[model samples]
Target: MTTKKTSIIKVALLSLLGLILIAGVYYAPLIQRLYFSLNIEDEASMPENLRTLHQYYSTHLIESSATPQPFPRQLQENVLPESFQSHGETIKTKAFFTDAKPTGLVIIKDGQIIYENYWRGLTESDTQFAFSVAKSITSVLVGMAIGDGLINDVNDSVTKYLPHFKGSAWDKATIANTLEMSSGVEFDEDYSRTDTDMRRFQMAYLFDKPMEDFLLSLKSNREPGISQGYNSMETQAAGFVIRSVIGERSLSNYMHEKLWQPLGAQDNAYWNVDGAGMEVAIGGLSMSLRDLAKIGQLYLQRGRWNGEQLIPESWVLESTTPSKPYQMPGRDNPLSEKPFGYGYLWWTPVDPNGREYYASGLYGQYLFVNEDKGIVIAMYNANNNFNSAPDWWKERYEDFFQAIAQKY
Candidate 1:
């Protein structure tokens, strides 16, 4: 063969090798973990819990082939001032939005819709994923279960509902501990690596395995209620407790009857389910940005809507206020970094100057409520990249809240 032909063939081979290497890296478990970390599934829908999972999944994750109806424009058209603009200029210039495009933004003030916008093919009718914000919603459901006497009390041991856990480490963990994220389970929340138990838990939910089985596999790293760790598995366990207490009601059905329909949600929302038809209460919820804003407004009004009480007034107050101290096992708690404390599943900003608390999710999904100023902002973004730096969300959230505070 000619020398020129040999050189060309060698270059082609090297190019092919590089392409394969790139493909492998992109499709590797590490990449999958990154994606899965942002994707929350209903633990009950897992295959091992088939009957429960099937029932939950069918009711929650409804995939309508038909187009979804849009929310009333009047619901959001008058909330903001005519000249008002979001921190869009800052967001566009920032590296965060450049990497992760926000799909939706909705702001409600004084029970009035003010501003709404969508980006990157998302619309007012689209049900954007909630990520970990579902944890906050799950917390609400737990409170509802308590009100209905489906569950006795927050202090009740988890094993009361799931007898299988009677002798297990979680047997003594109380519903309050899980709700407050004080469960001292021996699981890592680290997402930087793919082999961590966090990923394994994600795998369990993704592949539809029993969440309790996954929790049972863990050894106690710390005594229950002694420390705080962001254990997603604990949230799954909380879901199980809710199911066991509520008996036959699917998570979606409960939410619809108790919260959604009552709040006058403009559109149907979807929640991810596990193999056993259990709703993944930790964060697999998906709903329109406007509906999410309505949730914020509901909380802002202390669980009241249209002069009626949807959720217990006391439950809303306690759930939004910080209950546990901000301390982790070996690390400084991020909640301490702020002026506010940690509540049921909400993050209270420490700035005493700002009455702001939020339901924050992986990436940039936030349901920020500033009750004193009567402002509620719901933002949805695909920011899986920001999961590692949760503080990143706090910074932006504070900035936005500060701006809104100025407006009011």
Candidate 2:
């Protein structure tokens, strides 16, 4: 208990506190991101998280055009059907929304809004997270890149643009393969498992780790272009390829210039970025439901918007068509949840007419297009059971969308 010994102990404690303070200061942003990444999908807070995702992550702005195009509202009366058949069972339309937990729903026919609804305190102005629908956005950007001559061809090897991936898993993969989710890069898309690769990828961004590092370090589980497997990392690689070709520009900036502005986006969009400022091309986009419907409407119109061909018509056809045998819809495909075929970041239902395709995302986000009927349906939801939901649930929604299209 000597005075000199007590002073020495006090000095040690103060020095330790100083080091801790320095670490905290250095890691504050990362810690905050990690905290949000972990809690954003909590069952109780998911609705609020969907509404305010831009506030929780670092984002790049996809600015709206000066001349914003608005959807004309027709506002039909009692348009939704009473029931729809799926898996030979008739389900009530009201129960679909209850089960899906939709926050917003907009149905556009012939480029006019026929029905729009919002729940869980969401409004027309709110920009809910698009989840994996951003992948479809990235697909459109890729098509634009090809049309602009920035990218030589979709069949070009990814290493042609990204030299760093020359010896990586993507060495032999083509850009088209990545777009088709056939890159063979091993990434678990399952979100329920904490030990899965998807969880690790989440942690990578939460801790400010370079997403490219994680992407480049992966090894292919199978040969490229053999079959479809839902791998988000492949989309990230595609984003990197787009970044490489569009020199001196971020994906957000490129998308804004080539797609968002040209398409006449009404509201500003937000895209989450990794620590290295790379847009999370897998699933990061956020925008209002009307703007989301605009994406579908554009495709429904064959990639033309207001007399302008924003996306190539050829690309749109290729994006929705499954050319490969493995890409066909059946019970044999690796991830055929509901007998729907795989296209370039899009899904094709088993309709005999073969005119319907859509882009869907985690937690029940959908941007559906019925090309034959000229219908577009945009939906946002916070379904807690998305991971565990039965396969028939999605098919049921598809049937409902088609029913509405037929009714209109």
Candidate 3:
């Protein structure tokens, strides 16, 4: 080889070595975490991976081997064995079996489980991913934390509970602000943008480690409560704040004692955890179809279960009812939600009618409840068609349920 070529090779080797050294020193832990997580660019697993999310992550068990709440037998008059119509199309067991792509679907009416079905290799005993539907549960936990006096004031600075976030964008943030998605933290929740904050969050949470660190490093896009923003970090931050205040009472145990036991969940559940073993409250909850529906029924009854108020009635009302600028549609605020607005992590209709609300997630996980119609539907799906679906897509899915509601 020529002397010039030898010199060039030596220079290239040195530069690569320098890059390796820097990565090792600065991102050693993250590198190790990613090495255990995924492929190139440390990108999060795509929508396809959602089908087997429980298998992917190290999970913390939320067991319900303790007495599960029994469902009172009162099958609906217009059960699925008969028929239902959507947009003039007759939907039967076949669509739910092969077309609509549901993993499991449960329908409850007037406190009775009228109809239940499972498909896509799922059985009544199987547990499936609830994804962001878990955020609704996190919201419930926050309300409980408030009632428990662990968090005394929603208006107080969140940094008080989570001191590690001191001096950051979250320093002046309040619990209410985070709940409202108005924390103004610079988080890109746009599912379409691969480089957005949500993507980075997925990498840290699902693939890499130390999801909390990524949350703390965030800079403010604007002042707290000034503009609305949505991201998994808001829920994650809330989880941390609650965990810090609650002390050794871990989130998993708290859910079991306060929610699972009280609601009488049928079987055990699991929630995915991060590198530090904190519950991925943003997503990562797994449960059976019936237990998932029971949560909806709990809310439909305004947080009352078996004659007991598990969640405060006031909290349920506040969570279901859209507030402030959200009550008014055609909102032009950059951070304001279009089509429909949000209430306490729960999606609300544009009209602010307290009767309807939903908990939705990627790959077609949904919990749709129409209190006015006395209907609750929990659907688990693997919709290869629209896994990373946009908000408008979810809004349309509600219409499908509206049809079912009208028929019954």
Model 2 lDDT tens row, 198-237: 9888877777688999998899888887878778888888
Taking all chains together, each candidate's TM-score versus the true structure is 0.76, 0.94, 0.82
Q: CA lDDT, every prediction? A: 0.69, 0.84, 0.74
Score candidate 2 by lDDT.
0.84
Best by TM-score: 2
- The per-residue C-alpha lDDT of model 2 at residue 193 equals 71
Task: List, residue by residue over 75-133, the lDDT tens digit for candidate 3.
Answer: 65555433444334665645543544666778888888787777657777678888789
What residue runs in model 2 are displaced by over 4 Å at the alpha carbon? 1-15, 333-338, 390-392
Q: Say which prediction, candidate 2 or candidate 3, comes out ahead on TM-score.
A: 2
Which candidate, 1 or 2, has the higher TM-score?
2
Q: Which residue runs does candidate 1 get wrong by more than 4 Å?
A: 1-100, 327-340, 352-354
- How does residue 223 of candidate 3 score in lDDT? 82
